[model samples]
Target: MNTPQKAIALGIGAALIQALMLIAFAWPAANTAPRDLPLAVTGPQAAMVTQKLNQAVPGGFEITRPADEAAARTAIADREVYGAIVTGDGAPRVLVASGASPAVAQQLSAMAQQLSGARPAAVEDVIAADADDPRGAAFGAMVLPLVMAGIAGGVLLSLLVPSVSGRLIGLVGFGVVGGLLSMAIIQGWMSIIPGPYPILAAVAGLVSFAVAGTIVGLATVIGQPGIGLGALTMLLIGNPFSAATTAPEMLPQPWGAIGQFLPPGAAASLLRSVAFFDGAAATQPLMILLAWAALALILLGVGFLTSRGRTPASATTVSAEPVPA
Candidate 1:
């Protein structure tokens, strides 16, 4: 009931929430399962390879038969598939797209090794992660920072800018500049993300806008509680559910599906698509981000309209009310 008690309760509640979130996220990662992970197969004996793979790890791969090794490579580069198995005169080799997901590449490579038996097979990384940080650490590393940026952008603009137009402009400008700067640091300095600088930067900008807009719009509609709600959704729920370090399918049911629908997850997907897949798998994620941004704008407009309507009504009611002695 007292100040100290309230502060203690708040601290305890926050700690518990953080602990639960940690466990929820770590459990899935600690117990990863290969569930319909995408893979491509091509060569003279593609069908036979598929059958063998199916037998080895049932429900592990959602196999696609690319026309040939070339097509398979193209698919890998495009992130259509995590890896591909090519059969030939020599030992069958597994081609992996480590850039998209290093853990997936490792899983496929291990599977390939097991299948080879007495004769060993080669495991090639068709699209490797950054040489400096081959495990794609930088990609995973960016997730939390980006989320924080979005939240900060939204909360700050909502509090500082009085007018709707000013807030909108401020958030947009922040996203663009912040995104480009972050991209330059990650891609240019760290070399974590490869080339195509402008495109990657644009993806970053889009993600920032989605995050900032949503938060700002919520604040406009709901006041201070909106800031806390935004943080909970984007940071607490969104980040852990994103499965950035691991494949979404690898996570438990419902969570994986839920993560895909959130802004953080969508942003992560778009970042991967642009950085390694040449933007081949960008449509869905891009649309998701755009939709969030649109929703934010709509909410802001509605809030403004509602507030204006209420102002006149309150003024009239005050004049109508009798003064007390």
Candidate 2:
């Protein structure tokens, strides 16, 4: 095609992708995840506990069978888990941990009571998050590290995609994970203002890989422009609505309900569940994030079918040879 044709195609294609990313991904990620979180548990040995626990999630957790109340208390202090369970005869009681999450702590009491069949879940939110913190921020805290790390990873990939050493992509991923853990220490122990440091770092690392992979995939599908699109999609579209600070539940209707499907919202909710809710509420959010990641990878594969360069980013250009349909 001539210069004019090429420019038109690029504009149309860019517009199309941007529109999809915004409508399908970024728009929703922001609206569902909450900031302040209430963390706790009912019966530690509640027979159904393990049954529920077996259901794995993408959020953070450390499930342990503590011996007694004292042991559970120590575990919360160590941050072994967000809260603890002390199994007893009637039902069970929750123990709140000052260091855990306050929103969860407050809500656990009422929620626990509601959960118990004979009585209730016997809520006892242990490990209180800070007063200034919002339940939505709890989710944000978990996702912030991941988003920041992913942002860094996206930038790094942009630099490395044009370079000779392709394997460095993997190296970059590893570095992101390392940075996440390191940041966690700084956030958690150092008393970072926003939220817990260590947890944020962990989430940041996870988000880094997911975002980097998406960026990589988009670059493959659209070449250099994918990087720009990724920024617009992941950062602009995903972050703001990603927390309960402005979740759909509080909103009037469908917009609020639909937010959880967005990338940031999914990850934020998953992280918040882990950070404040003892990972109790992570089932769907994890699935949403995985689905988005999978779709991005599929796009990357399609891009790879037609490109010629050694770098993955080159595949994104549309004029390349046909990917075997």
Candidate 3:
């Protein structure tokens, strides 16, 4: 076997690995089903509503009984439940937080309709998706740009700015500017999302920094291979695992759990909370992003120390050379 053959084989192997990763992440999306999605039931007929919904889709909902429709609405706004059913003699009222998840809202509406039989349940979207993009497609689409911005920051900083301090400063600046610009376009100009620009921008900047810092840290420690690894983790694994297009519970086993911890998922959840859930659900996801950013900083520090240690020895070796020949 020659060098060329070895190189070809290695290239083929790398491609195969990428293909497998794509399949692993993408396959679950096609097979999504509701699993323990939260819902609130209220009033005297709560028991019947719960029973019927559970019968319709077993293990699909974690049903809670609120005192009345007002409480149900509060639960939805607080991100306690994805949707709610207020049972009454005339007709059942289904309250959904479409701003949290349009997919979940649509599914819940359908389920309510099925349970109502001939008469359709009255559905109300308490926190609807943005007026411009009512389906919430913009939220899902935003993930790609966030990921790209992070990648650009990481790669460009690493290449253009050689020093550790310079790279860090550059990445931070890039993240802040990029985040603000994105908010201006999405919220200010387009009016796709509502106000609270400062909070939104901060969350976006945090997400970008978390992702970019992780990539830069990995690359500093592992050289060229680190860049590929960063991409594989953030892009291939993080995006689909995020379940941005659908509720996390809708994803097949383990994936939903996995996605929640990733940067992209955390960011998406944070944005949704700020935009519609009144920032009630932001804490956990914010913690996740902060943890990632902290770990990346630690890794970067380690890389800096290791490189500094190697420099003196490298210089000594260069100086001590010229031993006869």
Cα-based RMSD of the predictions, in order? 3.3, 11.7, 3.0
In model 3, what is the error at residue 226, expressed in angstroms?
1.9
Candidates in descending TM-score order = 3, 1, 2
Residues 1-325, model 1: lDDT tens digits: 9999999999999999889778766777777877787889888888888999889879878999988999998888777788899988877899998878888888888888877676888999878888987887778889889988889889888888867788888877987898789999988898887869888888788888888888889888888788778877887678887878777777776777688788888888888888777787888888998999898899789777877667565556646577898
Which stretch of 10 consecutive residues in model 1 shows the poorest summed lDDT? 311-320
Ranking by lDDT: 3, 1, 2
TM-score of candidate 2 on Cα atoms, chains taken together: 0.49
TM-score of 3: 0.92
For each candidate, give its TM-score against the true structure: 0.88, 0.49, 0.92
Better of 1 and 2 by lDDT: 1
- The number of clashing residue pairs in each candidate reads 0, 55, 0
Per-residue CA lDDT of candidate 3, range 1-325, in tens? 8999999999999999889777866786677889999889998889988888889889988989888889888888889899898988877888988898999999889888888889989999999999897888887888878987898788877767777777778768877998899888888887767759998998888889989988888888887687778867888778887888788889886878798898999988998998877798889999999998897788789888888777566556655567788
> Where in model 1 is the C-alpha error above 4 Å?
1-8, 44-48, 312-325
Q: What is the lDDT of residue 270 in candidate 3?
A: 91
Name the best candidate (by TM-score): 3
- Residue 145's lDDT within candidate 3 is 89
By lDDT, the best candidate is: 3
For candidate 1, give the lDDT of residue 165. Answer: 82
